[model samples]
Target: MSDNYAASFSINQPGRDAGILPVNQPGRDTSTSEQSHTEPSANGGSTVSTRENVRPGVSYLAGRLEFEPSIASKLDALITEFRDGKSTKGNTVFEAYDFVNSFPGGTPETRKFALSEFLSTIDSVEILADAARRCGDRAQIGLNHADTTATPRIEYTANAPNDNALIQAASQIGSKRARSEALSDADVGPGRENDMDYRSGEKRAKLTTADLPWHSEALAARQDGRVSCQATQDLLYRYERDPGWVRRQVIISGVAPPTIPPGEWDAIFRGTPVNLDAVFSSVHHVLPPKEDVGRVGSTEIRFSNPEPSKRIQTANDWTTAWDDVSEATAIAFPHRARELKEYGSYIRSEFSAKMPSSHRKIILYDIAIRNFVQGGQRHLLTDFHLFSRFHSAIVAPDGVVSGSGSGTKPGSSSRGRAGGRKIDGSKSEVCHRFNDVGRTCPFSTASCRYIHSCKGCGSTGHGQRDCVQSGRDSRSTS
Candidate 1:
């Protein structure tokens, strides 16, 4: 099965039909917004959107649990605090419902325990704060967890020790040793075969080739006039910090590029003109010591040799097999020819790695030439991630993903394409149907997860319907 980021962990993909908004991978970026829905009605009574919007009580936080009248009263109080708890716990209270709903479901007894434990935890430790960061970063436990139901009657999941995922994730933040810590000289050289920082420098530095500030500086120098020495220096420094990232980006950024004449590759990829060291990698291993030059069965006797042996080298030092990645980049993005000319040699090596040159050549060439979708929609380079486990997902002649391919579902890409009110919440993509034309989505509020915006400007506050920008139709944009 393809172990895409979310599927790699056994956690289910949480939906947000639960009267709450959604957050991206809320483990790192803690930004979230709180919103309430109310609409002017056709008959003047008023129309309401968003599901399960029951205010358990008037949102009065009592001095204690006050559960004698019924669990319902207690529930109302909790939900009240939860929904209106913004600014109480700082980040988490800001997240409100999403933070509470992130908990997985459990049995009645376990759930009951979960309810009290959750409240107790909230009343005590800073679990909420950490959880908000975790949700923003990883474990996208949006809203509709399999274990929870509507509020008042709402429940939290507690399946014994196995279910404190967000809690565990919260505790783990800033806990790992920074990648730059304690590396011997030999460990800091070129080639990044083992590094795997998916955040791409959004968080830690294991796979970050350089600090964001340095990238900012580099970006300022990204123009055509940047000197060759500067580019070399940048690439080398990135290699020194996170050699694997440079290589990874090389493979990642170029895929299924627009086709061209087959022979066009010959100029840059063929023969020995392009160096192997620029594309492939090598490993140096010290062999075991050899015995003295005397046969064991012969009359001559020899003692075991203890001297150190020579270090053998295995290298993918030559090949005319694959297209020259630099040339490919130059051809694909002609506008960036200057940048490619500067950084292409060091950057393009990522695609080759340790794989056989012939395989590399055949594979790259085959994918490049193949028809993409079922109806022949061409594959764009951005649509492909070569290193993802999902890359081999079976697709029919049409663009549809095959159900038979484990972990690769049809149209999986569209589920979160735009952000969500259902899944991404207030961070959802704008609702152009409502904003641009004063028409709500055909699928109503809960079913349609887009932002509610001013009809004219598509922004909040009194934006003009006439203010809607031209050529920016969110309804048909995707």
Candidate 2:
């Protein structure tokens, strides 16, 4: 309430409080009476008056208004009337400005809040003016405020324009004048030559965009779209960024500090605030999100704005994810890299051949990726059927798969079951594992369903490991 408008607001003072920012107070002059930033006397000392620290009131918004300046000067008179218990008589600027100033202004945060609310009011006023013009109401429209502020501050009461006795008296005077002159419908001679309605004549053609002001360069640039958006991103690389000392301090404190809930604010005011200076530094190595499905009942995952860093990039491409992965893979592993290539091909064929975008199937593909093309879970040679000739390839030659991280152990007998007594193929069919014994493979003990029997003449007693048949009895393993 003093002429100093709170001496704690040491705005524009350099040494002790130079680092304190102006918050959202744009275009404001804040040279303190304590120090002169601009002019100096011959004695090398300040000549700044007490007026330097004096509050500008509505004059603070003079050149700094974000909207029309028409009603700006009227604000001083109106708000003065409001503060001194005089009537504003339903002027909007007074009520709104008083409401804004009614907020506590000791802290930069509260001042910033007041500025933001003021700007919002100005914007609403602009929008209202536009609507008023559109509705053929030429009177300059002001803010029709929501009553969160002014009504509580004063004994505010609504009085309609029709309720004023002066307005009724004015209307009566106008009616008497109309009767005296009988104008707007005066008697004239019947023979009138001039056409009163210019619209009744040959109509003018409606104008196209060609008739209006158009910037061709801007239009061309929009169509071309090679220009970068140049939108500034908050990467939290804040310190050591600003050239000015004040801005750097603002970064350390905060610029537009996050709006807190009422309870949180109360707690903050009561308790000590944690001044921890963001210990963790940001790194470039980022992982894909752990869970892509952000919400329940929605299979499609939507991209959200990345926090901590406001970096945003957008693109539309025709190629699928499979194509991109495949392209990267070939560069990492060449064509001769049989294992990786086989795995890639298998995954593509199973899930993304026609590129069916089923998320569940992609999950299955991820499971299969853990196992390679040479991952050994092959069928035992004892259980070999029509598929034996197909298995005789590079990855695993024998039925015992090397490095088989699976249910079957390597080099365990398919026939070496039932407490180690080898049962020949007297009761059961021939073991396919025995079929490959002498020629191509040595028998490895892996679990098999078929019995160890001879391929020739189905004899289990004579040929257990080797088939002695030479003439007219050698049959194929297939």
lDDT of each: 0.32, 0.30
Q: Write candidate 1's Cα lDDT for 146-165 as tens digits.
A: 12532232322222343454
User: Whole-model lDDT, candidate 1?
Assistant: 0.32
Which candidate number maximizes lDDT? 1
Question: What is the lDDT, from 0 to 100, of the residue 304 in candidate 2?
Answer: 35
Model 2 residue runs over 4 Å out of place are 1-57, 60-433, 436-440, 447-478
Query: What local lDDT score does residue 113 receive in model 2, on the 0 to 100 scale?
Result: 29
Tens digits of lDDT, candidate 2, 73-124? 3444443343222453244444654544564433333333233334433333
Measured by TM-score, how close is model 1 to the native structure? 0.21
